[model samples]
Target: MDFTYSEEQQMLADSLRRFIDTEYTFEARRKSARQGESLDRGVWNKLAEMGVLGLTVPADFGGFGEGAASQLVVQRELGRGLVLEPVTPSGVMAAAVLSAHGSDAQKQEWLPAIASGERIVTLAYLEPTTRYRPESARASAERSGDGYVISGTKSVVWHGAAADAYLLTARVSGSNEIALFLVPRDSKGLGVTAYPTIDGLRAADLSLQNVAVPASALVGQPADGLAALGVGLEHGIAALCAEGAGAMEKLIQITGEYLGTRQQFGKPLASFQALQHRMADMLVQKELALSMAYVAAQALDETDPAARRRMLSAAKVTVARAGRFVGQQAVQLHGGMGMTDELSVGDYFKRLTMLDQLLGDSDYHLQRFGEVMEA
Candidate 1:
């Protein structure tokens, strides 16, 4: 099979790459993070104008409705820049959930705005106590006179401070059935405490004390919540894999340049055979990760749920391990300066570390891959 990107995919990647290299420099990114800004509406609108924010939304909703492989192309570019925008959460994850399960009116209202970047949405599901197991959620929703009252605390909601709304997950009161709802950011009894992640991105802790929404806010039947959640997560992991690949690629370049320039014992560090071998190993890991990212992206279209799950799990495990190795080696090769905040290498390493834990770490997905193979 041909591995080259299609013309459209290559164009999209090139457009995004140019923007990152010219506009969103490392200093600009650090400035935004220092100010505690989660979503830069100006930058987001620019991305929207580029049609990137709508890459996954259906054509009926003013989007290109591109598939996972196309999404991987876009995300890899974002990763190279260490972009702080919540593109994956709002663009990929929320769009996937809405397109898959939202009602006609709901789609009509949200999709267009999301496509235009007029509004931002993200998934809020993980609880403080849930670890990474979304299925073990304790948040609850109760019927209340043609509406539902939801109460829960969601931890580390991606770009939560900037979201105009959230797709929240809650268990039906007194039942095992989990459900999804669209909660407005300004809804009464809802509180958001924003903070910067170690990776220089923003996240929030959400407090929902008896927040109420109309029955129309329900995304799908209670029984469908977990499946929908699973769909969202699978899309998220694919994006992360692609992003990790881009970040690793850039990190390797930075290390390579540093070694060629930084003198050691009256010669360049690149002259050392030991470090050359380490760089060679880093390249191998990066190639392996890029291949697995393609595997995960292609697997998104698999018709069989079991087959899809297995491929996604396998890709996640492989990419996560590759990311860990590439990140650690990149830092070590850069020496002590690599760990300092002044350099971008340390920031890339931090992002790579967080990516592993975001949608289940290497250990978790390795076990899942084994379970699926046995099944």
Candidate 2:
């Protein structure tokens, strides 16, 4: 039950941080943003080469054979660097979902490609009306002769436009049971509209009109999809919380440096008592959020499902609040220049705002926490 990161985990985090600092600087990130892609293929390949993409994939699948802690380290560094890569959406969430529930053949077919960064997959769970509710999917997969015909529209599919495939959630026709289906990007009757998001990331709206797939495409049993989704979502939320903690830490550092150098009223801003107190408060919030993130990461496979859910929800809520507070304060403290395109501070704020809405918002997760408590 020790909450501290192991030596190996710390090393991995440090290495990733150094790599990002050297290769994914603000200028390079801005350049990629201008080009309309969230990540550079070269950089992504480099990450794969470094074994980052394979951190959480099992060793039997040609991966690092690490666990949730290793993935958390990578996610934290990615957030600190303001990376726009689809690693989390594709590499973590989609990969985890498949690893958790996919059949042996499915694992052998996809996990290696994903681990090697040769294929990208994204979860297409959100619908226009379903909002963040995975269970509310209106998409249907009807049984055909020896396969299934899927018809539905998925909105806000992260990196869906560029993904090699999709891990889709759809309702079965007769049983009303939800199921996960692996649909290739080039499959017939699949349409996609890709665009940039506020956080300088790529997303797409997916239209599946009778997209047919073999019965083997189904992940696990149809009745197990919802439960499997919950597991995947837990991992996703924990990853976001870790990312939010890193971003909050970066915000604090940036603001501290700015206050030390920027003078106001003929003195350095950091010399002011009020600003110092505010920064202290920000640090407190960051520490609490960080602690929660670590707890949630370690609680990933806890015996008590309720404990796991509570820890994950608590971490997410804490991180969301900290992200919003730190982001807004960083911008406000930076004054007029903070909101301009020329400043990294502005980009950080935008990214944090977007993270607040991802997985589930603070309010949404808070209610979930309550539900878990009652249960």
Candidate 3:
């Protein structure tokens, strides 16, 4: 596959890097985290101004229509900066779903707001009882006049508290039909409990007790809800793979710099052959993960669902393995300072760890990849 990024994509990468250097420095990130703030609305607005939020939105909704490679670039930069914004679950995946499945009126009403950063949206697809089953919606939706009464809780909703609305998943009553509903955050009987996550970001436990929305809230065909959910999860896996690769890259750079500057036995650790070999291993792992990211990007929107799933699982497992190797080596190379909050090394490792569990982990995807290949 050709790896040609448009000149504009490169410019976007450069621009994001500049912003990171000027605004998302270690001090700023640490201050926000220490202050118990899960997200910086200021940075969120800045990203919107930079057009990062609109990259995946459709052109008719005042967006750039950027996808795959462009999103990979943007997400990688977000990883490098340890950005706390929910751009993946909220921006990329959400925009992809809405653009592909939302009605024209729905698109017109919400997409523009999302594009302008006037509203934040997130996907609520998980339930406490379901494990990676996009279609296994235990939450029941009772049919009301034309719409449905949503009653269920979505666990571990990423940045749910900050969202203006959610694309909620539930099983329609008296049938096996699954559906995605667009529920506003201020809807009656809806509640959110926010908390910090292991990655120094935010997530919330969402409860929906008979939350009512109009029939127009339904996203895509009811039976095809699983298909839409699959697409969203695929984008999620791709994004997480790239983000893991980005964090791995930063970890390698930080480890190498630490080895060069930190003295060991009256000489720089960089001069030690043993440490040098470890750093080389880290670089190899990072590069391997990066190659998998591009491969995942290539297969992101493959028309065949089975083919896309196989390819994404393949890339996800590979990235998870490489990320673990890179993360562990990075922390080990830095010794005591590696896990401390004062150093960014620990935070990067934590983020990498969290990324592994997003969508699916190496063990989970490895089994799926093997099964798909055999099929």
Q: Which segments of candidate 1 are over 4 A away from where they belong?
A: 1-3
lDDT of 3: 0.85
Residue 287, model 3: lDDT of: 92
Could you tell me which 10 consecutive residues in candidate 3 have the lowest summed lDDT?
A: 30-39
lDDT of 2 at 271: 97
- Tens-place lDDT per residue, model 1, 1-375, is 244789988998999999999998889888998898857888899899998899999999999988887898999999999999989998899999999999898899999899999989999998989877788888899999999999989998988999999999999887898898889999999999998888889889999999999999999887788888788899999999999999999999999999999999999999999999999999999999999999889888888988888888888888888888999998899889987888899989999888888878878888888888889
lDDT (Cα atoms) of all candidates against the true structure: 0.90, 0.86, 0.85
Could you tell me the lDDT of residue 280 within candidate 3?
Answer: 88
Off by over 4 Å in 3: none
TM-score, cand. 2 vs. native: 0.97
Q: What is the lDDT of residue 368 in candidate 2?
A: 85
**Model 2: per-residue Cα lDDT over 1-375, one tens digit each:** 554679988887888888888878889998888799876789889888878877788889978877777777878888898888788876788778878898999999998898898998888899999978899999999999999999999999988877999989999999879998999999999999999989888889999999999999998998888877777788788788788888888888998999999999899999999899989988998898888888778778787988888888888888888888888888888889887887788888888888878888888889989999888
List of clashing residue pairs for candidate 2 = none
Best by lDDT: 1
